[model samples]
Target: MTPEHWLNIATHGLALEAAARVRAEYLAHLEDALEAGESAEAVLREWGDPHTANRELSKAHLTTREARYLPAGYAPTWAGLGRALGEDAVPLLLFALTALAELRSGETAITLALLLAIVAAALLRWLVLSRQMLAARGRATLYWLLSFPTVLMAMSCAVLASRGAEGWHEAGRLLWERGWTGLLIVAYLLYHFSRLLTALSAARKAEAQL
Candidate 1:
């Protein structure tokens, strides 16, 4: 069968409870617009894929993405900031934790220096990584990604990094203690989330509920 045919069959035949809810919701909306003469097929066509539908429903229930932009020290446009933040997170986390551990024991001078060295390495990775220039594209909404596991990972890492800095846990706190860095990442995630929500909320409703 063709890809579209398979997509339709698969989405229509899916038996998950959540999928049922989405289908039900779509139909409810479609029913309310019956005078418009739009069939479920037409509605689904505009809505795109079942994957997209799933993402919309999930974003309604979750925070969705993390580190969508760069911090105040980062001097670039939103796209540049997003790339830099995502690229920097892991290595920075590694460095901060390692450095903090050494610091707590009062002997991190060299270790701290090494962590400083990694800052550039992380920047290099961010510079060379396989990120799509999301902020650069006005149409790059993340709605079709929520149900996907990666979206959750992105969401979780961003959340942990934010709250990870707020308490007495020095290592974890230091990991995100760069103050504005946290804000940059949170703002970026928010922007990405807003786009995802807009797409999910605006998706055309389907008829003849599954």
Candidate 2:
């Protein structure tokens, strides 16, 4: 292939921000090879197929969907969906049950408060997920920030749970009366939040190596 054709293949998937630099670098490499008495086709052949070359060149500039955390060509299966959504699904089911119970008991305030809390939590979760999506767009800073609110919220919950355990006896009993589901929820949040932190760390490390 011609030099321009080779450059196109190698950079087809690269980010716009990095594409120019990468193209220049590849062009320089080709020029150096030509000056060394190498033919254009030989140089391109040594670099391998365009798709493979593109994958190599684009690693550092890959989006979150293209990163190692998500991988390229990720197909969604029912089992995978279950794994991804199960935690949120459980809370949603519990919320629905609690809402129904409150409605039946005519506790309008409790029902309203529960709905509002659910909405707020869902909104916060979406904010965090949006940050994660930004991180996938070659922004390492957002990946690092992914765990901040989760960690902060988890710590705050722990503190409140502790205070309730010591002085807020009635509230503690109420939580217990919920069959220890509060504890389970707290643990789930901690686990899920930590996983986000871990995934971001891995993705950042992988990108850095590129």
Candidate 3:
């Protein structure tokens, strides 16, 4: 049978998200088989009955918690953040607790730092998880959004490392008190933005070749 025929039967009772992944995987397998000189019939015979395969695949898919966290598909930026939170729930909770502690102790800088860290983490997680579902341009956009904070962090590191021991101490102090750390965050973000653009350019080239 053709790959589409198998896919239709295999995905018959599956949810949209699960079906998409199964379809993609099956298509890849079909590609490999065809490339290896195997006939469609042979591939079908080796792959087994689509209905049976779908049942088995669906069983595993339905049992997973990950599907609830970040199922495949594109979403708006806000939804992406929700997915990221779901995916990294435990770590985020811990970070929240730390931030709260810092706040209670009047460590505004530390609290702000923690909050920024969470934002960065959220952005990174969303980009990584959702990139596949995104178009090449969307993927590039998300990466660009991520680069801004990264650039800031890198710059802050550079500034902190710029001088001798005394200068290092001074710079470090200035980073928090003078709000240079905030600048650092901004720099980091810009850097990620640039990286995303670079990746997008590469993807465009690759697509052009195709």
- 78-155 per-residue lDDT for model 1 (tens digits): 576465555456756775788787776898875565455455443543433335333312212322342122344444
Q: Which stretches of candidate 3 lie over 4 Å from their true place?
A: 1-73, 77-79, 87-91, 120-138, 144-202
lDDT of 2 by residue, 1-210 (tens): 677887777777555545677777878888899999998889888878888877776655543333434322112454433432343455556666777877877876644554455445444434444333444334333332323344345445665677766645765676688876978866776776665655565456455645
Clash pairs detected, candidate 1: 40-207, 70-81
Error of 2 at 199 (Å): 7.1
Q: What value of lDDT does candidate 1 attain over all alpha carbons?
A: 0.47
Which prediction has more favorable TM-score, 1 or 2? 2
Of 1 and 3, the candidate ahead on TM-score is: 3
Q: What is the C-alpha lDDT of each candidate?
A: 0.47, 0.57, 0.62
**Deviating ranges (above 4 Å) for candidate 2:** 35-37, 58-61, 67-114, 118-210
Error of 2 at 145 (Å): 11
- Which candidate has the highest lDDT of all? 3
TM-score of each: 0.23, 0.39, 0.33
